[model samples]
Target: MLNIADTLHDWCRAARPFALATVVQVSGSAPLPVGTALAVDGDGNVVGSVSGGCVEAAVYELCQEVLKGDAPPTRARFGYSDDDAFAVGLTCGGELDVLVQRIDPADQPHLTAALGEVTSGRPVAVAQIVDGPEGLLGRTLSVSGDGSTEAGAGGGEEWEAVAAAQAGALLRAGRTGRVEVGGDAATCPERLSVLVHTHASRPRMLIFGAVDFAGALSEIGRFLGYRVTVCDARPVFATAARFPHADEVVADWPHRYLAATEVDARTAVCVLTHDAKFDVPLLRLALGLPVGYVGAMGSRRTHTQRLELLRTAAVPEEHLARLHSPIGLDLGAHTPEETALSIAAEITAHTHGGSGAPLSWSTGPIHRRQSAAR
Candidate 1:
């Protein structure tokens, strides 16, 4: 799975044989989404999780069976409800389709190459034949954004092409899931299901101030899996020693650097400089871009003044509406750590399409759309 590729690669490098159980599909209210994995080594060591602790024992047992050669790579489904006969069901009343397959030490070298792409901030997709003819089971192929591919043994050239094409399609769209391939005259001619899992680099978070609050927020952003960059015009304040958690520290005017930066819909821009000269120009550029979230730190009075300056600068009303001034949720935070937590919470909610409402006030599946699979 993409989330555990680092751990899996390490195990392979150590020449340890392991069985990887991946949740390939789900329905109803599931505990985890597709591409989630749970691995068990020969010594019974485990890494990552699939069911948030609900159905791990069952998945672990299945991994053990695969490790012992008692079974081939197999697809399994688990479902439980309040009235089910078996006691082993997701407490959330969801169903999960899991695939368990053994990994050999010889396959590690090939896999490590793919992992390198992911850790180096490139987009990659790994396609595994989870269900098909006997000969194709457990076969895998990885495709990166540069159109390079890596395939495991036992896969024919024709099948590799088909899988790579499908993986490339998903990679372009930045998606992960199972796709039906083959059955065509030029290919295997027998339809098969391939689980195409994609791994994209972490999202970017650009903080436009190097204050104490910036350091705290950078730490929280890193913990939340964001590539944080702290930028300011002052080099003295924007030092690696000052903000160790930030992935980069740029000593340039916020507007000048952001104008040349590439941002997609997943990028978040936080204007924490709080000065009219810096905040006005930076917000003017950020609000026009197609970013996920754009928030500025200021009091009510300061926000009001900034709005007037933005309006005078010809910023559209629609763009102005996208700004979240007086940034962060109303957690009544005063300390740097507390304020950082509040801001990170707001960013998380915004990225995941959450309402920032209390869970007790919400009703429905908790994981309704928590993952990128959908």
Candidate 2:
């Protein structure tokens, strides 16, 4: 979480002793992902969380010891079993591997380097492994960097190497990946989960259109935490005054802007330019690449028209189907902001494979609010 990052930065600046407790592994319907984080200070103040109120107290205690230099950084496990009914275990019957370690503000130039990349709105991955006892507990390893890798703490031919390498790859992709180690397939023994966090500071949202809905969508997109860009050729309406929330107001044609940026699988492009002149070309550009979400604002009839245009443009129907036209879900949203929420909801649904249905109508585990923070 950003709070953890900021806190860590401030603590480092103040020369206060602190340790980071990161949830590096999760199993069997866990509440958080592999990279979910929590910070424990010397005074026992906590920021962020690793589990559903099950592991914090234990991890925090470890933090105190780490701060006192009485305990070395290392990996600790928490899970639920019938035997651990009142122990430091998951009440939800899941498992997590936490790496708690003391951070030497003096030796944290590497962390601050990575943090610098993040603060500048760039993406960087930080990898560390805490296993075994203190003294040699958690070691930071360098796997990749656009420039050079600063030395991390761990290295070996078996579990450590595999863990660092896999985590490095995931960080480059800005993703979370799981690694099973030891000679079951490779390595020496057991499985080690490497949590790779690719910290991309601000996400960009590209909107194509100069319509009223475009303005509304831009505002809503900003609300949903996007660095909104309203790109349209018409200078008349693509002004900052019209869509005040947009971070950038570009009076350029859609195709030109699309070609300029690296709008890969993480960017969201919404084509509110319903006319063929804009939508068709923009759709071709959108479909040609792998944007995270491609939404076109139009009715069912307009969607058909766009499809026809695409077909005539020799765009594949398979690619054409990727566009979510009549864009949002069937929420019957009439107002622009409401429609924007529906579209955002649909985008979330598409990305996470949620059904966009009520929670009571679903089965299995009910996702808590904390889990959604990740």
User: lDDT of all predictions, in order shown?
Assistant: 0.86, 0.72
Worst 10 residues of 1 by lDDT: 365-374
Candidate 1 residue-wise lDDT, 92-129, digit = tens: 77888898999885854557677677767688888888
Model 2, 306-373: lDDT tens digits are: 89989999999789778888899888789887788888889878876778998888766554222211
True-vs-predicted CA distance for residue 134, candidate 1, Å? 5.5
Clashes of 2: 5
Best by lDDT: 1
- Scored by lDDT, model 2 comes in at 0.72
- Clash count per candidate: 0, 5
Give all candidate RMSDs, comma-separated. Answer: 3.4, 4.3
User: Which residue pairs in candidate 2 collide?
Assistant: 72-134, 140-152, 140-153, 141-152, 182-186
